[model samples]
Target chain A: MFFLSPFELKGDIDSVFERDPAARSILEVLLCYPGLHALILHRFAHRLYLARIPLIPRLISHGTRFITGIEIHPGAKIGKKFFIDHGMGSVIGETTEIGDNVTMYQGVTLGGTGKHSGKRHPTLGDNVVVGANATILGPVHIGAGSRIGAGSVVVRDVPHDSTIVGVPGRVVRHKGEKTYDVSLEHGKLFDPIESLNAKLEQKMAHLENRVAELEKEKRRSA
Target chain B: MFFLSPFELKGDIDSVFERDPAARSILEVLLCYPGLHALILHRFAHRLYLARIPLIPRLISHGTRFITGIEIHPGAKIGKKFFIDHGMGSVIGETTEIGDNVTMYQGVTLGGTGKHSGKRHPTLGDNVVVGANATILGPVHIGAGSRIGAGSVVVRDVPHDSTIVGVPGRVVRHKGEKTYDVSLEHGKLFDPIESLNAKLEQKMAHLENRVAELEKEKRRSA
Candidate 1:
């Protein structure tokens, strides 16, 4: 059974202030941030779950999901300084495990591939940042100080100090120095589709050039 | 000012019942579905927006967004028999126009490309079904009876009765018969990424065979 200490709770609130520049006051954060509300509710539900209370924990989780649109299963284990920005449609699966100082954007899903049973969800290491609409599936592990780009779908393990991007996410950058900055700019990520399209266009141009050369040779022969 | 008739309201409720097999009673739908609640609130906000009531409409929309997590700008126009399933994180931008009998799933964003001014958002024709987490961006038009697959990022216009999939969505099937089935089965849709991967694998196999044949010819010549 895991418990969040009073120091951890204060750290959570303080982390929001440190991370979000728009956070003006503690009162506003307490009242306005649905992500904070959802996390606070999740703590109670997790406590109930640790006590081996089944239905009540689930009920509390359901209520929290309804209010926040961020569904965190009571069985998911999260560490300190966990922040979810604009957490609508974010789902943390039952078997998910997270380390300290993790930041997540909206529409992120830590889910299973629908084939596994126990411990199906992914485990995140410390100082990880996940971008908007990213889906990390299966029981893979994401190592410390990694950045997952927006709209990425990761199914495999990611190494430490890596930047992951694209569908069936690929590590574009690895073994870099860990920047403790957790602020994620979603629009500035790498686009795999656009890159693929550019490659295809270049291939088409090469083929066209070859065809034109062949035509000129045929004319000379004639 | 746009007004929702009693008949339209009944149609909206009836559409939910017809689409969702889990919907047992009217009471259950009224109380349970956050999508319906958001839509109901949007109607009032839209009316107030049309009447030029300053700040009140925006306040109503803000409250609705907080409660439901479905953000519909008051200036957007929507027609009858609209149904949204698991509507959390669904965002309808201002100046967006949606036609009748439109069905949408969770996390769907009808947004702009951030380059346009007026009518920046997409316009949906009648009987369009948008799958979960599908993003339709820019001022593109989705024609009547089109089906957008789950997790697709659509930036272009779609033809009538077309089935769209992939990033920067492509129409895989077109000129199809309109079934008018609002119940969208997300798992069963065609995956363009898988298809592309399969094609690449086949090409690789062919290249390998050609290389082997060339080597055999060289050995014979030697």
Candidate 2:
């Protein structure tokens, strides 16, 4: 029931190297990386689930959650070359759909908001990057080449090539420029609030000057 | 080596009921609630650590991490009635100090930033509430009754009764009024960004009106 060719296994291993800078060697990755372990077990469990086999798949998924601290429901559909970095406390719901070359960081959740039945979880398009602790809830479609910022809560459909940030996630960028970057560099992410604050500071300075000038003009007129 | 009086055990279990609204029964909490399990194990491990015992304490801590998905270094100091809700992916680093009646949500990290040894992790004062996915790094002090919002990354010392929010956590409210709230209601958290944006919107409107009045006055003067 559980089988993967050497080539396919190597592809999965290589996917880790593309996203994580800390990965040292194959031995270290095999021994230390819980994310890879979770994916491997998830793949096996997913096969069992697809075959309409009961209980064993769920047991395998539960055991995987215990071992890796990453919970992926067996019924979730995932594409090739997907990688989860750190991945502790990350959860993918039963009906969640993930696309190829997606990168998910630690504590991320692709979850359902309510008790609704079919397709309750989110759908991610190819080359989507979900940052640490980001929660994407409900059946939202995150378009290709999109990036969800760390700690953002997304509940809506995002268009292609978009960058989402803030709680109740807002699409801050829709450049349509495809991101080939597998490394979801969180440090460089655009903070909309900080930028807005800076603009406000400038406006305040300008307003102070204008007010002073107005006061002087009024005095001269009197 | 492992013993707790019935009264003490009841007190610990009662702490859960104080924080979590979903906690229906003590039996259910004992059966489930990884947070409580982790704390029980940590208390045992911490005693072993204090007795100048080595290896075994670390081993117990490591095993507890695997079982509960929460890591608490034995060297960390924790006080009474401390409750961790959900607590998956939560980490308490060595030299971390937590005061009485402290509440921590899921994915919270009390961590060190640099390699320097002494008191590397943050200290939480009594009644401090750390929301989900909040990362408090370095040897900072979180004053009593301070609330760190969900997804906040705090690196600095927070004053008593302060409410912190944002990526590089900022003190949004410094009210001296201490919070007795055990439930870290994340939905009600004051978003500094949203407030700033609202203020900006109002300012923009005021500027527009002022500019229009200035233009009219200039036309009348001409």
Best by DockQ: 2
Evaluate candidate 1 and give its CAPRI docking class based on DockQ.
Answer: incorrect
Model 1, range A30-132, lDDT digits (tens) per residue?
Answer: 7656678788888878888988986988998899888878899999998888998667889999999999989886789999877657889999999888866
TM-scores, one per candidate: 0.60, 0.66
The DockQ assigned to candidate 1 is 0.11
Q: Count of backbone clashes for each model?
A: 0, 0
Q: Total backbone clashes of model 2?
A: 0
**Which tens-of-lDDT digit does each residue in B42-149 have in candidate 2?**
988888888988799899999998898989998899988888866788999989999988988778899998887887999999988887678999999999988887
